[model samples]
Target chain A: MDTNQPRWQRRKDARPAEIIEAALTLFVDKGFAATRLDDVATQAGVTKGTVYLYFANKEELFKAVVRETILPNIESGEHLLADHQGTWAELLWILLERWADRMEYSASTGISKLMIAEASNFPDLARFYVEEVVMRSRKLFATVIQRGIDAGEFRPVDPVMATRAVISPLMLIKVWKQSFSLCDTEPVDLKAFARFHYELMMQGLASR
Target chain B: MDTNQPRWQRRKDARPAEIIEAALTLFVDKGFAATRLDDVATQAGVTKGTVYLYFANKEELFKAVVRETILPNIESGEHLLADHQGTWAELLWILLERWADRMEYSASTGISKLMIAEASNFPDLARFYVEEVVMRSRKLFATVIQRGIDAGEFRPVDPVMATRAVISPLMLIKVWKQSFSLCDTEPVDLKAFARFHYELMMQGLASR
Candidate 1:
């Protein structure tokens, strides 16, 4: 490969996202306190100095990693709500399926593990996540649950609490798969778990 | 206060539990790497050297703290199941209430936070917790769910998965409260949340 463009310029263009990806992996693998920036830089295929050029510090890089990975996907929930025209139960299922699909690839899984692990120590990061991610997603699902109730598609239930009920098992399964799989001797079938949740959900929410 | 007896014997008698409690508080307050033995000692009202006498190091102390606080509670659950006779749903709700009550005051809450936060870095600790706490509890609940199906008290579903479904929300909420309350401006009404879940669960598990 010929170098028409300067090294610094090419590195700068490629580094932010690559670095964020690396940072996410390292942070998730090692607790925030234990992770070293040098490791993140090596994971990114860049120099530690290069990472500093893009991100001011480890905390800034962490915030950037989160925003880059999670926030973008999070906003789509609202749009999914707006664009979908279906039964609320169907919409709810679709949303959870979509999330599970994304979780398969996204750094949000790491972010989630990180949040549960470190939220108490890092209030600012935790607050940002709660506001930007948790509250927004809860609102999105709450709207769907409320719509379902209004349409008589679901048995009357507290939209907020019921949404959480619908969400918790799925979320917990994902988190468990990410965090505790090391100790889990048996492999979990993600598809079947989702399906079982859906079938039970159908019965649970049915207006009957 | 007069110490007629030698101080070493007095500390020997009282110190181990106090040190464990202090370690639990500090480990939860600061992530493990950030927590200092000095801080734990100060919290426990002991000397750092005294902590060493009882606990070889931080990790050992952490495990001991877990054993002291959670393992004791963990065994009682199996006993509770052995002693309980009622509807399966009724038994399930009772177990959850007992857990929630324990979570409110127990060091297990902090130990849980620590485990999730640091599990990757400390696989041995995680494995011990998974074996001693998680599996045993899962076994007890799985038995109840299976009995419900066998007796036709609840609808048919994979008892293991169904038990997980029942457990995930309650467990996640407790972990969230333990780990993320700093960022949570709106305090969760634990009782209301549990009540809503129980009602939805009644539907979810009811015989079709």
Candidate 2:
């Protein structure tokens, strides 16, 4: 809207985010292997040449989409973990609540789907995502579970397995909603489902 | 080697199955949209013309892969449900055991990954897969849960939601093994994880 500003400078600033958003939609819709970079550029309202200016290739663009959409949220999750002072159960409940609010309901959730779907095809991207996103999220859960066990607030178990059990249903439901929920008539209330899972997991983890 | 069998008759019977198997591998690797029918035909040691004799199109070949690999196992599951006379917990545990044994260590799990990855782009295939595969599997769990609730053997809970909860971790772990498990150094013991999940869920569902 700034008529006086240089067009190249304005386009340069906005294209990366705009292109990333468009690419995420395509990747989520078409999947990584099926999606074409030229189509992504077209969808983002830019030329293929223009798209190449920001990303060197399709893989780089794919990487940018994952990095741009998911990494910020992961960083904030780390911040939440560092700053939180609460019951471990409450912290987990809150952490998952934030995950649901931030990632599950948005385009970012597609990053999770894309990684799960195409990890074998793109091992390097998958490995990077694990290192950057999945492990960080697991550590958040594992740390809280460890805290709970150390504080005599929860029963002893493998913190890692406990973390997997706690998160599996949540991740399944999220992926199910995006992928298979469309074909089902009886819908599971996701918010209530999350609440119930938290309660059930807490009960299972409770110190006897 | 059955020397008595005619060559064309032998090739005719085996080619369809071989084509389906090769298609599953390609669909799992390259995804539905990117996988060419020609490559699948060649991989199966047949001409594109021969492939067309069995399947009408690439989508049909994809559907055949799913049908051949998954449908028989689902039928057996349905038969197990029909034949079972046991506690719901036992039945549920048994159902998951069969699922893990049949699906987790095989290429069939890749169908799950392909469906999730490509569902948005191919809603018809997704819907068909749901009708043919997912609903049947969910119905197996739902029926067991409903029977338990009706007989007062388990606590009252939404059978459908509870069924979703029961299958969630099993499905998640299967998909995770195919996808992210390669990157993980510390592998979760899947058998122990399944047994523990069953126990935890039964504890939650216990009426006493």
Candidate 3:
């Protein structure tokens, strides 16, 4: 798009994103404890000192990975909720469809599995993830569910608990793809799985 | 109860179970790739030779750990399905209640988290778990769901996918307890979580 720009300038501008992309790949493949910053530098085709220029440390690099890759999805979902003009059920369906689409196709889906696997070993990172990503995403869902309850479109369930219930199946599928799908003979159809899970949640949350 | 039995004979009889318990603990705390049989032997208070006497290798030890700790829960769940005498909703409630009780209080609950974390590294073992534990458990839930549909007690949905929907939350909770619970400021109450999940599922699956 910017072919007129100098190649050196373009490379300089792209370096941080390229490093973050490399870091996400490595973090997802290897647990946080086993991944090294120098390896990330090698994968990104940058020097380790260059990596330190963009990121203060491995944890910061990881935080950047989360911020760059996942936070956008959360932001988009939040925007969807804020701008939605339809039945709460329709809004929920759209939000989940976007989510399932990302989880099915995006490399960032593996970050959740990585977090689950390595959370105990890195308590600070885990807490950061919980506060930054987990709670934020859950808040988005909770807001939608609470609005549904207020509008008498959903059953009067606690928004916090309802958010957990709605999210758990999606979380399970993400973890499954990263781990068990390696040996799973009959892998789930991601679309069917998502459709059925959303249907179940819709039915469960509907006002009677 | 067996106070009259000789100490050596009793210890000999208990060796396999002791080793299995130790293996489960180590395998859960440290993943399969990181856990060494010698460490398990040490934890079990047995010699390396003693461990080998019972288990052919680490894989065998892991398998035995599953069979000892997890299979029993599955077996008992099967028995509950076979012996149930109630409405399908009530039966499902009881089944989920029992499962939640075990997950909250049992050592075996950690095995689910362990398998999720290490399944990719150990594909053969993952396949083993899928066949022995996952499929068997799903079959139990599918049978109940199928019966409910046939008897006009629940909505018609794919029993296989429905079984997945039902189990996913429980899986998430198990993983959370082992990993994110370390840093989660507002950890969920296990009973309330189980109850709400069960309620949500029951509503989702109802014939209404």
Best by lDDT: 3
DockQ values for all predictions? 0.60, 0.58, 0.76
lDDT, residue B193, candidate 3: 82
Q: For residues B1-208, what per-residue lDDT tens digits would candidate 2 score against the true structure? A: 5768999888788889899989988888788888998999889999999999999998888778878888888788778878888887788898888876766467988788788877877889999888888888888889988988988988888887788778888888877887888897667777778877777778778788
lDDT per residue as tens, model 1, B57-164: 988887897788887776787787788877888888888888777777766677666677677777888898888888887888889888888989888888878777
Error of 2 at A69 (Å): 3.0
TM-score of each predicted structure versus truth = 0.88, 0.86, 0.97
**Better model by TM-score, 1 or 3?**
3
Candidate 3 structure quality by residue, lDDT tens digits, A1-208: 5999999989989999999999999998887888999999999999999999999999999999999999998999888888899998888888888888888779999998889888888899999999999989999999999999999999899898888888888888899899888767668887788889888888888898
Please report, in order, the local distance difference test score of every candidate based on alpha carbons: 0.80, 0.82, 0.88
Instruction: Report how far residue B65 has shifted in candidate 1, in Å.
Output: 1.8
When just chain B is superposed on the true chain B, each candidate scores a TM-score of 0.88, 0.94, 0.95
Candidate 3, residue A104: lDDT = 71
Query: Is model 1 an incorrect, acceptable, medium or high docking prediction?
Result: medium
Cα deviation at A11, candidate 3, in Å, is 0.4
Ranking by DockQ: 3, 1, 2
Quote fnat for model 2.
0.60
